[model samples]
Target: MPITPVKSTKLYHLIVEQLKQLIQSGEYRPGDKLPPERELAQRLRVSRAPVREALVALELLDVVEGRVGDGWFVKRAPDSSLDVSSVEGRPPSDILQARVLVECAIAEQVAAHHDDELVVGLHQAVEAFADELRRGQLNGEADRSFHLLLARASGNAVFADLVAYLWDLQNGQFFRLVEGMTGNERPRLERYVREHRAVYEAVETGDAGRARDAMRIHLEGVAKDLLDS
Candidate 1:
């Protein structure tokens, strides 16, 4: 028998490949729940990070579904006629618009119903975002965290999970494309810092309308930049 060569790739990608193969081979059927992340990681003899990332990738492909408070399950077979990944491949501007709609509403909800505990968490998220900015980090995790924290403060797990799903969709390819098109990234990052602070302050003060406006304006600006750049 001839030997096949493996190409170098990220560990998460390799995990995704194996999981996809499992789905394709019918070892896992539609609606079948997969092993827990830690169990998968232990079985595969790898870190849980790669397993979690792979599950996210699979979910994007619509081959799996992640239900809140429940484990991940196979949603569909790879050979299904549905092209869910194409839906996932919508333009970045479209995603940003959807984000603006959801997140702006979340900002309103948080401002309306915030307590001392939620306010404290929001403050911590804001400080974390600022610290990342001061360090000139472009990884975007802290920025995403700030937004995710706001969604969580909305008292809705679905909103927080949706925000995470959107962030996952903005992968390396998205960043590379944005970087190639935009030249004013530094100023834009600075602007994001300010806008985030504005949103936080509005929510902290219990100004619902102001919080909604702040979030809406920030996302609208992002949509414009991404579209017009």
Candidate 2:
């Protein structure tokens, strides 16, 4: 049950199966350390994205555990009923990457064509998010509004709906497993509000380049803080 390159597109489950089989066969005992993500991705001939996704899913399922700086370790042997495939839709990082593409474009477009009403709506979105944080809460819904409003401001129904669809998945089970890891702290959440406001400011000033850069920086921050070491 050694890890090997998998050709399937759904690599999250493949990684899960490989790890599960290894544990089941007594190759990895409880408390055994798993390979680093980089090494596993190299062996599997895939990027680290799916490997990280599978590891997080395993952590959620109680089969493994991730130590913030120390890396991942076996929590326990996989039970007969453990099913990684039961994980919903695309991985969280996958969704974030998609957002980086579409949302950044949306930001650029909205900024390029500034409208008074749109600016007001975006400011309200930013304020709503800040209000939730002020209450010492991590409000995902408030955060969702800003991006959706920006997309709609682009005057492209397709962009708005696509963003909405991605936002739906972003709030789903696949993303929830690691949600707190990114936004549980007052400082981190505050930083996110600032990031949102920065995007809003750029759009309000009609700075297309700055809007795109702000959005990209914000999403990159999420990926680094949530996904990477």
Cα RMSD (angstroms) for every candidate in the order listed? 8.7, 16.2
TM-score, candidate number 2:
0.58
Model 2 residue 191 CA deviation (Å) reads 0.8
lDDT tens readout by residue for model 1, 1-229: 2233577478987898799899889999998999998899999999999899999988988889988889999998877443334345677877887798889999999999878898998888888877887887777788888998899889899999877776666543266656564456778878988899899999989999999999999988877777775
Best by lDDT: 2
> Which residue window of length 10 is worst by lDDT in model 2?
80-89
Error of 2 at 130 (Å): 0.7
| Candidate 2 backbone collisions, by pair | none
lDDT (Cα, 0-100) at 8 in candidate 1: 47
Predicted model with the maximum TM-score: 1
